[model samples]
Structures are given as structure tokens and as C-alpha cells.
Target: MGRLRHPGRYRDERRPERACRGRADRLLALLSGLAPYVDARFSLLCHSYGSVVCAHAAPLLAQTGVQVSDIVNLASPGLDVSTVGELGTSARVWVAQAASDRIGWVPNVRVFGVGHGRDPLDPAFGARAVDVDDAQGHDGYLVAGTSSVRRLTAIAVGTGDAHSVLAAR
Candidate 1:
């Protein structure tokens, strides 16, 4: 997991960006160490800042011959790259954003290297956007009985397509 220190409300904006870069570097190192031991294809399920870490580490992991089956980004703040293809993995990238999630309201632009980048759920980002009907907010996707949780579970286990999951309910 990315060790992003949650700063106080009054902290400088640059602190989070710095923290994210550091965490991404650490995550890349960790993935380099772990890739050799992963005998089978794997998947990544990331939330918030964790998605940013994954985005950075994925290219390096791909270089090590790690086959990533899927990458699920839930309520991501944004990713470091403008396009999901920059991740350099053949993984099926999935994204979810609750209708009521405040995080979704954040500007998707990166300014002065502060914000991460484009929203993953944006059609331009090239990710499969999943429907999160029951998720009420940024954190509600994890709550039991929420449609978001069920849909995510299905995607994680490779049982169904994200769009199909929404249609089934």
C-alpha cells in the first residue's frame, strides 16, 4: 500500500503531491521485488491514492514479465499519467466513481504538478467505467450490501463485466 501521510487541513498543497511521488517510487520498488515470486497473472484493486501508486508501478512490473489481469480503481483521486495506456500493462483497467462522491468533483487537471491528472472514469481515459448505483459517497463503495461492493466483487473475481453487473441488478 502507498504510505500517503494525511496532512492537516492547513498543510501546503505540495505535501500531498510529494507524498504521492514518494509512495509511487516505493510501490515500484516493492513490485519489482514481488514480481518474480508471482507465478500466475495477478490483479490490483486500488482505492484513492493507492491507484496512483499502482499507475506508477505498473509499467515497471510489465517489464518484469508480470501479467496483470485487471486493475480496478475505486474513487481514484486521479492517476499520474494522462492516459491509462501509459501504464504499459495489458491489464483491463476498470474505474468506478459514486454519483455522490465528493472526490469526483475535484478538478481533473494537473496544475504545477499538484493534482494527479485526468479522472480515470473519463471516457478519454480509456478505462471501463463501472456503475456505482448504491454508493452514496467516496467511502460508501466499501459498505456491505451496496451495489458497488457487489459489482466490484464480481469484477475482482472475474465473474462478470462491470457494465453487465450493473445491468443484472
Candidate 2:
């Protein structure tokens, strides 16, 4: 999996919403370069700001014939895209947000281009929600022994149903 980083440190608290268009373009280029070498369809697991980049790159990736099997968003701040269907791909969309995650308090709405947009975990956002009850906060989803990690692992490896794993939690 490729990890993306913004060019500059987004430290300005006043402008919490850093422009992600450039980052998205970089991600597109990275994925395009990887497409030829990758043999099987892959899943995208994005966390926080990375989800914003995924949202922006989804359509572009489809246009390039990238085979995306699934997209898992963990503690996403927000997504600029209006609908999951607008992602322009056949990938199954999954989302998880811990109750204790501070990012959950971020407004789901976009204003002055500040916020990304709607919460992917919202029922109306059309994504399958995974249980993260055992997660502590924004960064806890991947912690070892957590139910979130187990479900996420299942989703990543395509061995078990993520919803079923969550149900057992």
C-alpha cells in the first residue's frame, strides 16, 4: 500500500482545512505508476486526511482503470464528495468511527471550503458501517487486540465478512 503525505505541515489552526487537491494529484500519479505492476485488485484503507485524498482520487483512478476492490475509511474528518456512488467505482465502501474519536465532533457540513463535507459513517452517506466500539479514539482502530483491528484485518484480507465480525463484537 502507498502512503501519501501533504507537502506542507498543516499547522495553521485557523485554516484547519488544508487544500487537498495537490495531494490528490500526487496520489493519482502514484497509483497510476503502481497499476502496471500490481497483479490483483487492491483495497484502499484511508485514515483521517487520507480519506479526503481517496475521495478526490476515486474518480480519476477509475478513469485510469485501476482495480479497486474496496475502500475503508477510518475516522475520516470529512469527504468533499457528495455521495459514495459519485466515487465512480464499483469498490465496496466501508466506514468506521469510534465514539471517543475527537474527529467525530468536526462538523459534517462544508463551509467556506473549510470542512471536507458529509461524514462517511452517516447512514445517509451510503457506506457500510463497521463497529469500532472497542477503539479508544481516532488513532485506536488499528491497535492490536481491538475489535476494530480484527474487523479491519478481515476486510483487508477478504477472508471474513466485516459486518459479521463487527456483529460478534
Candidate 3:
């Protein structure tokens, strides 16, 4: 349920390919040792650029016999979702976005020859959409006592009422 580290050239200068490769490499190491040390019902909770890493890593991990229970992307840019082809079919995917999110609002067209635009809100993306009230920017997904927090906690524990998950938060 923790975030994965992805190494790259520079935090602000990385190409998508570099990011994906770093994530794929790191996840391979994690999947290789999973059987003896991790839970069978593991899930992925990704945010911002981390979601892109998870997207790249999921299929590779599946090929190694690691099963994911869920893959939640809080504020992700589009990935090669189509190219990867059903990477999270075995996992319950929850994609949440705030209407006011500043970064997400950036038009999901190609940018600087690197496309960082995948609107999980788009019907074609195939993720269950959740709304996060007042989640207006990059760092708001982890806001204490918010819908994002509730959804993330639910995925972490494996079972919870999604219907009312974010009510108290």
C-alpha cells in the first residue's frame, strides 16, 4: 500500500520513457520477492506521476505472477492504458479527480513531445470515478479527512463500504 520509488535523470527533466523504465525495474524487484514477504491481496495506490509508474509496472508484475487487488490513481496523467491492454483486469480500479484540480485541468493533448494527459474521468478510460470535494491541486489527494483519504484507506484494508467511505472524511 505504500508508494514505489522510481529513479530517473532529474525530477523535472525526466522523459516518460525514463520514468516508465525506472518503475518497471523497481517493480520487478518487488514482485520477485513478494511471495515470501508480502500479502497475496496486494493493491496499488498511486498519485500524480506515481500513477504513471504503476501503470507501467502493473502488467510487468502480472507476468511474474504477482496479482494486484486494486489500482487507485488519484490524479494521474494518461498512460499507455491501451497499449498495456487490460493491466488491471484482476484489480478493482478506482480513479478519482477533483473538478477543480489545477494540474488535471491542463488539456490532455500532447505536450513537449511527451503526452501527460490521460483523463481517467473520460468514459473510455474504464475506471470507476469518484469525486473529491475541494481537491483542487496536486497535493490535495492525501488531505486528511477527505474523500481521497477514505478511498485510499479502503483499498489498503481490502474491505470497506465504498458507498459511505468518504462520508465521514
Candidate 4:
């Protein structure tokens, strides 16, 4: 229900499951408890490392029929997209990355000696990519009035499309 800044705390090695899972479990349990009081329309807005947490939690939430209305990921490091396909199809999934982002230019994913390539702008990724004209590295996402913020805000409100994400840029 609320925006989680650091989602990976639940599963990342740095924090480990014990430390973070309690909070996540408590949150999920609370959501489950409050599901009857609230409407079904809901979403999980994950940014950066938070996407990883959402990816891990999707299955458990599914079992509870909580229904993920949408997933908005911004300047993400791979959230294991292949695993996401298994996450129910009802939730509208979206992703946005700046064009001039140097950090995302390289594949941040590596597994079993194989690595996934960069495609923050690839249409096949099934998520719209918002473009940024600035050639800055990873943290260029917070430039106030830039296209990145505009498109990101639009997508977050469900008012933007692929073209709108890059409009007038």
C-alpha cells in the first residue's frame, strides 16, 4: 500500500531473510488482514532494489489472491523478468529508464556464468521506457522538471503510454 524504498532487505544477502522477512511478512500479513476492508484495486510501486523484493513477493501474494494491480519499476537493476511472467497476467507491469543513463547501459544481470543484455529501451521487454536527454549516470532520475520525472509520474498514474513516455523529448 505504501511505497517501499528498499525492497531487497527481505531477501538480499546483506540483510538476509531473517532480518527483513519479518517486516515483509508482517506487511503482507497486514495486507491480507485488511483485504476485506479495502477494494481490490491496488499496486506496488517499486524503484531500484525494491523491484527485487516485489519479484520475490509476487508468488506469496498470489496465493492469498491479493492481486497485484500494477508494478511500476524505475531505474531498475534486473528484476528477473523471466520469473515475472509467472506472476499472474492481470497486473499491468511497467518499467521506465532514461536514455542517457550510463548505469543501465550494461546488463546488470548475471546468472550461472550467463548474463542478460541491456534493453531498458527494448520494446520486447514488455514495459515502456522513458527517455532522458542528460548523459548523466544512474542517479539522473531525480532532475525535477526533466522528461524522466514527467514520464515516470505519468506511468505511475496510469496516464502514459509508450509514446507519451517519450513525448516531446
Question: Which is the leading candidate under TM-score?
Answer: 2
What TM-score does model 2 achieve against the real structure?
Answer: 0.84
Q: Identify the runs in model 4 with alpha carbons over 4 angstroms from their true place.
A: 1-27, 62-67, 100-102, 112-122, 132-144, 166-169
Off by over 4 Å in 3: 1-14, 82-89, 110-113, 134-136, 160-162, 165-169
Backbone clash numbers for all candidates listed: 0, 0, 1, 0
Arrange candidates, best lDDT first.
2, 1, 3, 4
- lDDT per residue, candidate 3, 108-165, as tens digits? 6556656655565566766766557656677787788876677667766776455744
List model 1 lDDT by residue over 21-41, tens digit each.
Answer: 556667666666777787776
lDDT of 2 by residue, 28-140 (tens): 78778877877677678888888887787777777555677788888897778767997776888888888899998888888786777888876778888887789997789
Candidate 1 — which pairs collide? none
Q: What is the per-residue lDDT of model 4 for residues 62-159, given as tens digits with 9 covering 90 to 100?
A: 55546666776666666555444654455667665655555476575566523323343455555544555552556666578876667666765667
TM-score of 1: 0.79
- Candidate 2 backbone collisions, by pair: none
Better of 1 and 3 by lDDT: 1
Clashing residue pairs, backbone N/CA/C < 3 A, model 3: 78-118
- Among these predictions, the greatest lDDT belongs to 2
Q: Could you tell me the TM-score of candidate 3?
A: 0.76
